[model samples]
Target chain A: MTTIITAQNLSKSFGSFQALKNVNLTIKKGQIVGIIGANGAGKTTLLNSILGLSVYDGDLNVLGFDPYSQRDELMKEICFISDVATLPKWIKVSEAIDFVEGVHKSFDRKKALAFLAGTTVPLDKKIRQLSKGMVVQVHLALIMSIDAKILVLDEPTLGLDIIYRKKFYHQLLEDFFDEDRTILITTHQVDEIENILSQVIFIREGEIALEADMEEITENWMVLNPTADNIDAARASSPASEQSLLGRTSFIFNGVSRAELEKLGDVSRVSLSDLFVTLMKGDNDA
Target chain B: MIASIIKPGGYNPFKALMLREYWENRRAIFTTPLVIMGLSMVLIIISMGLLGRAIHIDGQSYTLNEMIANMSAQKAQNISTHINQILMVSTLPIMIGAWFCMVFTALGSLYDERKDNSILFWKSMPVSDLQTVLAKLLNVMLVIPFVAIGFTFIFQIFLLIVGSFSTLGTDYSAWDLLWSSSNLPLLVFSELTYMVMYSLWALPVFAWFMLVSVIAKRSPLLLATIPVALVILFETLFFHSEYLARFIGMRLTGAHILQTDNGFGQNFSILGINTPLENIQSAAKPEFWIGLGIAAALLYAAILLRKRSSL
Candidate 1:
């Protein structure tokens, strides 16, 4: 596998507050990596550093270029959709397409127009006139049309309705993702993108709590639903987290043997969101 | 260093950036001049209707029909020259409007993008910060001025056509008198020269406004002005010197490089516009080069600020 992005001892501070603290990370090409965090957990700060939108300390490289110093060259291969709708309100839809096509050598005008053809975005209307959902759709349409090596989406589907959000990921997987490309997404809606992510990095309080491939995470982590009678035995096993609902207790264990957990009760694979909650809550408790 | 920054593989994106600027500011760059011209034309037509058959030039009255009937070659030439001068002077309002448009555009160009967070979108493209800032500066310095000048030339032609229509049935035609004797070519050349000189002279001020736009989080207008106002005030109260005020005044008004000994209001003689050699000589003035150096420094600062400005 080809490593496309690497960060070593990356630190960033805003005045007296530290946003990112000596974090290290690596992402390989062709992986759909989800950067899951709570609000203000340095997800945006990290993504901004990657996009060359902000300065930071220590070493970081994207496509062999320093994102801050060589942003213009790096941008030719990387594209992003920020959390907010950033298209200028004064710009018409067609003009936006015209401008991107004019500047980006890899921008496909017909592809952008084709994407908009499916949506309610009119070519002549200014961006301000569009609904918030349509504004996001327009931004998405613009980004998906670019032939970039990496796509960094910072809450790209934020505030979007369920239907659009589902279609957004579906279209991204079907039309945009390939072996030559990589995707880095940050969102609070962990479960929404869980199925598409090949890998996950859980960030808590500006530090990586866990970084693992989906296969490794699912294989090693298990949710054990212990019967009431065996609850004490499950507790003795020292699970990462415990939750109770409808008088039934469920314990999440990381790296405990599946057979050993099965002895307590029913043992099943853990959902990404459940794992994320366990890891985050476990860190909080610690 | 600046030349080298733009010297390598910068042509296509630079042109695209210019077109993008045109698209964004088409109203301020193109329509402001035309609207000024339209309003002035209407006023001119209404006045011609009210002040019928008597034309006034330089406070001298001439009965239009009789004057043309007995008009001499010298008188015809004088009237033609005055009419041409009137056309040129009429462009003054448009020029003032263009300056206002330029200032407002420069003040808002970079600031508005950051306010709306569209700077993120622009930065997502492959264009360097240098290219973006240069495109904006060019719009203020070259685009607005030339658009204003073009509309002014069109308005001159429109007035000449109206004058020709006024002399429709006369034995002495405006075509023979006004058109033949008109120094339109020299007027155009002179106007071009004046606009170029004015742009160069005012470059630093425009650059300062743009730099303020990049740095100000809000109210860029106040940010651009209040500092200069304070500096001038501080100099008055403490240093008791008018050095900064005079320097700003010279930059704001026409400088010797732009104005000849006869001044702007005089007739457009062939000798009126400075010769190429004289223009080159005047450009060698220390203040002119100093102003350009300041402009370049301010622009460089703007580019650096824009590069790190996440907001």
Candidate 2:
């Protein structure tokens, strides 16, 4: 697979505080990578650097161009949904379509209108008149209409209800994703998107804590709930994290064989949320 | 997908950017001029009714129609000059309205996008920051003034038609009474020339507003004003000079240094017909070129600020 994005020793700072510290990464084509991080954990800083919205130091490239210096050229093949409700409130739905069609060479007016036809968004109404869910719907329709190679989403469904949130991701996967495209997403709601993420990166305090493919993570990492007498032996295996819920204790292990973990107790593949929490706690302990 | 592979060539992004500005500020750019036309039309009709009454010129009473018919060649020429002056100067209100529109629009053009977080959406587009900033700048400098001029032309034509009707049932036809006496084509040419010259003269101020809009996080108006105020105050307090203040005044008012009296007040009497051609000569002044250079610098700074700014 072709590499779509590459960053080597990438760094950014705001006044005294450094936001991203020497982040080196390479994303391959057709990968849906989820960047999981807590607040002030440099997820946005990294995204901004990748999207060329902010200045950064060191080598960085996306789609064979330096994003910061060549953002206009990069944007011809890249589309992003940065946060929710970003469409201008003064624009009519029809005007937004016309503007994108007028400016973006890759934009398809018929495709945008056809997507809107399935929604409740009215063409004549201003964006301010639409409901928050409807606004996101319109935004999604516009973005999906563009024939782009990479799509970046930073909390694209922040305040939406559960119904719209599910629908948003569902539509994206069903209509937008292809083997020729790459998607990068950052969100607080990890579980909802974990099923679709092929790769996961956990960032903490301006540093990348964990980066692994979904299959690799599931194949190597496992969680176990041992019997009362075997708890001490399970602890000997050195779990990444341990959680005690009700009267049962569960231990999460990394790079440990399932046959070994099954000897301790019942073992199963670790969930992404569990892995995220484990990685975060591991960082805190260090 | 095959059709999408072919890039859309007919679509011009610069034209789209201009249209975007118009769409966003349609009220200020378009409706304000139309409202002025509507108000002026109402006032003209009211004055027409009042003029229907008998007027006494040298104690000889005559109706409005009879008065124009009774005028001699020189007398009618004099009245025509004053009427032309009134018509030309009447465009002042619309221009003033457009000036205010330009100032506020420039101030809010960059600030409002950041305020609502829509800058991210705009930045996501393929257009360069230079294109975006230039579009807003030209919208205020060129587009608004021309739109105002269009409404002024419509109003001027309406008034001339009304003048023609007033001359009916008398010796003078519309041509002799209104059309022939007025040099409309020359007047229009002069107005357009004056607008272009004035926009160039005032370019620095608008550019300053846009720069302030790009830099200020909150209260762009206050941020824009306080620095200039401090400059003026500082100049007055210690330097004992008003060069900056006088330059600002000259830019705001259309009084070029090339004029003998240094003001437009004495430039004309009954008609300011010669002002346009005279204004054209102001382009040769060093200050005019200097103002353009300053505007270019400010606009470049604005583009850089926008490129670096985050939502």
Candidate 3:
């Protein structure tokens, strides 16, 4: 697979506080990667650095261009929807369409309009007139119409109803995703997109705490429900996190053998949300 | 080299960016001038009705036409010159209105985008920071002036038609009396040139406003003005030199362009007769060039600030 983004020792600081600390990451083309992090965990900072919205230290490249200096050229191949409300409130739906069509060469205006025609967003109505969900829909339609190589979405559907959120990801996968294109998304509703992501990167306190493919995570990471007598045996495997409830104990282990885990008690696959909480809680303990 | 850096494509992005600027600020760029001109036309019509009713050439009542018919040729020439002067003077409000438009628009150009988080959306496009800032600058400095001039031309035509109607039944042709005596082509060319030169002269101020727009966290207009006001105050308090304030005043008004022999208010003939090229030749002094250099530096700073700005 071709690498679409590469960052080596990338760091960013706002005043005395470090926002991204020596983040080394490589994102390959054709992968739907989800960046999961709590608020102020530098998820937006990382996305900003990759999108060329902020200055950073060390080397960072997107689509073979330095995102900070060569952003104009880089943006020609990359399209981003930075949250739902970033579209100008004063712009009419048609004006927004015309603007993107005029400025972006890869933008297919006919396709964008056709997409909008399927939605309830009015072409003559200003963005202020549209509901938040409709605005996100309009933004999504416009972004998907652009024939870009890389698509980055930072909470593209934040605050949307569950129905719209599900529809958003479903339509995104059905219409926009292909082997030649890559998607990088970050959302608070991790469970909603967990099934669609090929890889998940968990960030904590400006550092990448965990990075693993979904298959690797599913195959290797296990959660074991242990009886009181078998708890010590489960602990020997160095589980990432442990929790006890109603006199039953559960342990989340990262790389232990399934047979070994099975000997302890009932073993099951760890959910991404549970893994994310366990990893973040583990960092807090560290 | 700068062109390549600012605009990767030949010309399409710049045109589109300008069009985008127009889209965002159509009220300031287009509708405001149209409204001002419309109001001026209404006032002119009202005054013409009032004058036709209030005044008479002799004891027997006569409309404005009989008064012009009874007047001597020299007096008619003077009246025509005064009429042309009134038309030219009427443009001053529109020009001032355009200045306010530029000032407010420049102040908000970069600030509003960041405040509303729309800068992220704009930056995601293929256009560079330099192109975006330059488009905003051009909208205020160049495009608005042309729009004001276009409205002014239309208003002038309407006023001329009204003046011709007011002078009906008179031997003196309003065309000959007003239009012929006023060298309109020269007037328009001169006015256009003056607008361009004035925009250039005032570039540093607008550029400074843009820089403040990008840098200030809140109240960009106050942030933009307070520094200059402090500097003026400091100059008066410490050095007792008003040179800075005078320089700013002169730049704002383009006082350097008006000839001392036929200064702005003393000779209304300057409006009709003076060619813009001649005005530029005479007023092409060191301050104008120096202001242009300063403007370039400020614009470069604005580009840098905008590139690093985040919301």
Candidate 4:
């Protein structure tokens, strides 16, 4: 596998507060990695450090160069779209687009303009005048216009409505993503991008709590529904997500074959959200 | 699957950032200098009325050619005082302009990007930290002064043109102000150069602001100004020190205006022998240059920090 990012022992502190503590991560090319965590769990900090926005004490290599020292050069080949409404409020949509065109060599003006085709974003109207959702659309259009090898999208759907968020990801998948491209997306809402992700990386308090392949996840993470009489048998299997309703136990396990899990009772595929919750709690216990 | 685009020895990313910032500001107020200068000319006419002065020249034949000279550096220190007042008062506004530009641009430069968490875009690029720092340094310290120069030059010209005509009944004339002896081109060029140099010398201040902007959570310019204000308060309440005043406190008042050795004239007094133009102190000194160098270095340090800083 060709490695796209390798972060080792990365740590960052803001005065009295430590934002990140000894985080390590490695991502491969042509893989879509989904990151999920609660707020203030150092998810943003990790992405920021990777992007070379904050000074951190650790080692970071993105596309084979130290992120801190090689930000500008590395940026040309990477597409980072954090907030949805990133364009300046004073700039017209077209002016902002034109400005990006002039600044970024990889920015495709025609593609971005085409993305806005038939939209109400009058190229002349200032960004402040546009609706909030429209602003997000404009920013997304600009991001997709740039042909970067790696894409880091941090909460790109924040502030966007449900419909737009759905449409946004759909369009992103339709137009931007491909086998040769890599994307790292971080969000608490795991179920939305579930189908598209090849891997799930769960970060908890500045540490990679879990990293699992999609195939392995379904294979191991099985929510078991069995009568209380068989709970002892299910428990013996080290079920990860086990619930008791009237002492009728339900369990999820990892590292067990699907056929083996069926022997326990009522084994089925686990949703990414269920998998994230189960894996986080079960951890090494399972 | 790793792309080969990030090889060593490629295009500089710092230059791209510099160009981006420059173009944004240039688009915002590219013609501001000329406009401000024209407005200043109108103000000059009003100032002439307040001074109750008429424009004329008597050293040669009474003509427009002779009258412009009278509008120049004082035939008697009267013009010097007027120029001094204009320079002294306007220094604040120009500085305000510079401060506003530096604070706004620097505030937006890294802070806005960080606020949006656009470090991802920047981080993926192949440019080095040093290049990023260099571009920011050049934008604030270099491009700003040049923009200011454009404004000052246009402002001076406006003053000369209207000041010459408004003094119709007095010692001022368009020809005299334009031709008589001032050598408008050289004088204006010298003044503009002095302005540029002063800004360059003070590059550290703007750089400091940029650093604050990059790291500060919010309102970096305001936050930074408090220290400068506290220094002044403490110095005033306690002992006096010229060194501190010259180094930091003096910058607060901005007393020195464009110190150019124009070599206009050598003054002689009736009571005592006068120092010749050659004996006068030069505008530039080693100490100032040293300070300038230190400031430039400080500005560069900000750039380096910004290069690696998230957002």
Output the number of the TM-score-best candidate.
Answer: 2
Order the candidate numbers by DockQ, best to worst: 2, 3, 1, 4
Q: Candidate 3: where are CA atoms >4 Å away?
A: A227-237, A245-248, A283-286, B1-11, B50-80, B261-273
Angstrom error of the Cα, residue B98, model 1: value is 0.8
Q: Tell me the lDDT of model 2 at B267.
A: 57
lDDT of 4 by residue, A40-84 (tens): 878888888877677788898889767666666677777777775
**Could you tell me every candidate's TM-score relative to the true structure?**
0.92, 0.93, 0.92, 0.76
Error of 1 at A33 (Å): 0.6
lDDT of 1 by residue, A78-104 (tens): 998886568888888887777777678
lDDT of each: 0.83, 0.85, 0.84, 0.64
lDDT preference between candidates 1 and 4, better one:
1
The order of the candidates by TM-score, greatest first, is 2, 3, 1, 4
lDDT of 1 by residue, B159-257 (tens): 778877767786666777667766777777777777787788778888999999999989999999998999999999999998777776667664656
Which structure is stronger by TM-score: 1 or 2?
2
lDDT of 2 by residue, B1-311 (tens): 62242233336788778878887998888999889889888876876686564744447787766666555345767867756775787777788888888889999989999999989888888899999999998899898888899888888888789878877666677887678777777777788888888888988888999999999989999998998989999999999998888877778665663254444556533234655668688888888999999999999999999999877
Error of 3 at A165 (Å): 0.6
Candidate 3's residue-wise lDDT over B118-190, tens digit each?
Answer: 9999999999999999899999999888889878878877867886786776567777776766656666687
User: On DockQ, who's better, 1 or 4?
Assistant: 1
Position A226, candidate 2: lDDT = 95
Better of 2 and 3 by lDDT: 2
Candidate 1 or 2, higher DockQ?
2
